[model samples]
Target: MQLVVGRIGRPHGLRGDVSVEVRTDEPEKRFVAGAAVATDPASAGPLLIESLRWHSGTLLVRFEGVNDRNRAEELRGTMLVIDSADIPPSEDPDEFHDHQLIGLAVLTPDGERVGEVSDVLHQGQDLLVVRRGKTDVYVPFVKALVPIVDLDKGILVVDGPAGLLDPDAIV
Candidate 1:
């Protein structure tokens, strides 16, 4: 399985160093030097971690053969992937991997199908982007709002506030 671990940000300096928006919790294990990570577009590369270090709270990485800022800039916005048979389990029972939620059905408390989980947006809190007909709804993934996330059933039970799904008006 290819799991998304991080995204390459803009070049940090002139030495081909780039900042990473670490998506996985296990950065220490995933971002180790010499590790190979697949890129998003398929053509970019399996970006090898030639060097890895942390500055304050953020992680900085420099890939092998990418020796200048221009080379690093080319990789900006590219998602880093790691292929593993074992995706690390979430320590918190309530937490879930983005992939687990991505294609699940979204239903209201009354069991009406609202949409499908199209994407998982990670701001301060993760938001479930559901595609409902012609529109997209952003539902905050909180216990109060999304009470149930049943991976087996492939459904997310939401108790969204009025206008949460329909911004212009209540559904």
Candidate 2:
């Protein structure tokens, strides 16, 4: 399993360096020199971190064998992924990665089945998009609405107003 660590933003300077929008919590540990990371499948193989530095609050990185502006440009829009095992385990009981929530069944507080989480979106606020039948419903991933997220049981208990889980209420 691989976890996305960052996204290739754009070519930084002319020396084959690219600006990366860090996505992981531990950027310094995962984006160091000689660190093994994989970019988009378009690239030949996993990227070898040649060098890394912080610039203007973002990460400036150079991958091995990519030594020109053209090479850096080729990596734009690529997502950097690292082995999931490389990331340190989270100690927080309630905290979870978005990946873990995907595909989990959503249940209402009244023990009614609502839908399954299709994806977790972050647009200023966290949102859980659930798929029920052919329609998709968007629910705020707040403590008030989502009271319990049991990964072991593969269930997410929602506590929203009646009809909020209905497909017609989503539009």
| TM-score of each predicted structure versus truth | 0.80, 0.78
lDDT of 2: 0.84
| Stretches of model 1 off by over 4 angstroms after superposition | 1-3, 24-29, 55-58
Q: Which ten residues in a row have the lowest lDDT in candidate 1?
A: 162-171
User: 157, model 2: CA deviation in Å?
Assistant: 1.1
- Candidate 2: C-alpha RMSD after superposition: 2.9
lDDT for position 7 in model 1: 92
By lDDT, the best candidate is 1
Residue-level lDDT tens digits of model 2 in 42-80 = 354588889998987879999999899998998888998
Residue 16 local lDDT, model 1: 98
lDDT of 1 by residue, 7-51 (tens): 999898899999999987568878889888888877999878899
RMSD per prediction, one decimal?
Answer: 2.9, 2.9
